[model samples]
Target: MKYKTFQTIILISSIFLSIGGCVTSKPSAENNTNYTISPPVSNNKMVHVNGTKIVDGNGNHIKLKAVLLEGWLMWNGTLWGAGLTSETKITQRLEKMAGKEQTELFRTAIYDHFITEKDIEMIAEIGLNTVRVPFNHTILEDKNPLEDYSARGWKYLDNLMTWCERYNIYVVLDFHSLPGGQGAFVSDPEFINVWHSEEHQQRTVDIWKAIANRYKDRQIVAGYDLINEPDAPTGKNLVDLQKRIISEIRKVDKLHMIILEGGNFSSDFSMYDSPLDGNQVYGFHTYNFFTDETDVKNLEKLSELAKKQNVPLWNGEFGAHKLSWIEDQLELYENPKFPINGWTFWPWKRVSENSNRYRNLAKIIPGDDWKEVAKGISDLFGPSNKITPEFTKKAMDSFIEAVKAENIVYDTEVKDLLKKY
Candidate 1:
């Protein structure tokens, strides 16, 4: 879609909003989700949210600030897994992410997350106001396939909305695993050799229509992510077909937000002369995994697009390939042009509470999942010199030795992790 700026101000004034604050420690839920620390605790970055200017889901205006909960394993597993499911586990994680303010979400895979009303209760207590539900085509229909909402999945979706409404968390129905997997899912047999086939395009539109009709009410459902990320193809026809999908989504869900992605995987955000509609918003996926550009360039692009679109530009996904960069990015070196409502890196931990080995098992929590702890986050995670056996034994000995002295206090948290490895 194509988006441009607007300059119409009848009146303006400064407003004092309560910025959120929280402890740097990983949160625990096995006992309670209460926090004991105070702010100016650092967040992932200097999250500067643009204000006064109005924005909206459809055509209306609203304020935006969000964090992506991408793939939180425990949140889904604890609620809808095959064996054990716990509300306490999921709620604890969400509550921690909510910090002290209302948080939005961009859930990567909401697959099999259909569970009981009790699950919804836990989510509400955590302070979430929105959820993006990604539906695999299989769940919508079983055919080789046209766009059709799966029989069993649609029923569960309705139930999900019912529970969401009760808890007040809005929903974004994302067509996550599209026929031709977007990027990571690109290995799927469906899209490998046929991204531009006429069959693929028709199927997508038909499926969207069915979905829009099923949930026409704009109140509970926030928006549709259109088709995840559109990439380049060896065949020109297929590439054109990919862009057409956005037009199709707009046709049906005109009132809701249409999330248009950039070229060849969501990573590259360059203008190809072919731009998104001005009415819709541009979606980008940024990561430290593979990049040659400087942070300055990245920030400049974000700002330029914001000025051009006059709409929100969201970082659908981003995380540090290594744990070391976490603290570095948190310093907020670059100035972003647009308002980034929220973002979700890839997946959350499968076991949110188990890592409480007295240590955090929830991925977002410190040491919960090594991958997440290391991503775009530092300080909280220890150095690489940590993965040793003797180091652990010595640290344990020192801790035991320190406890013997009643007059002293020893903080050996980092030491324990070295030994655990």
Candidate 2:
């Protein structure tokens, strides 16, 4: 629970590396022949929930082997080497270090290069059928309600959805960051507790409702993941908020599956009494620290809950461990008695400069006094206080190149394990 600074850095890195590494290898000709790559099924159909299984419109079962796209729309300080702790801080510091125009340029460069068409092709090639795209609420909504928030965020998401459609990969849109921070980390920047504030809770519901309405008919979107690893200090409050969000979503889109995560970082489900809807999936998250027996026992509890509610159980997030640890957890997930519907690995990529490949995919900008910045001398996230426009341009170039290059390291063992089931 208490992660040292270095360990936290390593864990964030490993989370991305472990998942991203799985898709890095180029599929051999024989391997490609093993799996038939087909055009996406007609967009007229939607994925729905059956008893303990996710099935397509035709009733064919779908086991969603997925990977999470982290640190793209959402910023994690440790993962990106910014040391600012939140996306808001990261953006603010970027603006301070470089003017608004230059900041936009930097962001565009990183976002454009971070994930490309090739990545989606590789994911589909590996036999995984779904991806969970984690995004910050701010991307689609500005602080000022009157301003148009959908334009900027939609551009990127639209691109991703198009790519997913091309590859027949279902996407689970995850609202990782809420209006007010839901948890205590960079991913959930609103630290004031979203559940306690009526305004924040409404904002959360409104944003989800808007998203549901927009993508309701798009089959490429697997579902609306209501939230990601929400840490509601009060369990009842979390349940109430989720109920409200689900109610609002159903008002518009009843076709797509709705994913509801458990409280306490998605590891506890004691508050849940029944499935919110027939097409709902209960979400849970696990880490690599648990013992194998403990993992099996906990998953069995989830299975029991799924059976009791007559819905499916999804490991919405898990990873950041050795290949052996990942194999053990995957085995537990594949166990028939537990009957887990599916799981999404924590991250798809991180910058791996050391032996421990669990760090951020984006490397730190070199020639900068990042150590002092990490220690909190100043909030600037670039090279230095005396940073010139020329230096900024060069640094941004090198940083972008490093990110694109570092994001492609492969872990053959993890890939092999995932390809099995």
- Window of ten residues with lowest summed lDDT in model 2: 28-37
lDDT of 2 at 237: 61
State the lDDT of candidate 1 residue by residue for 90-165, as single tens digits: 3223224332121112121233332345444543443445555555555566641322336656766788789878
* lDDT string, candidate 2, 144-191, tens digits: 333344686787888999999999999999988887656555333444
Error of 1 at 190 (Å): 3.1
What TM-score number comes out for model 1?
0.53
Total backbone clashes of candidate 2, pairs 3 or more residues apart or in separate chains: 12
lDDT of 1: 0.40
List candidate 1 segments past 4 Å from native: 1-123, 143-149, 191-194, 234-239, 271-275, 290-296, 320-337, 348-421
Best prediction by TM-score:
2
Q: Count clashing residue pairs per candidate.
A: 29, 12
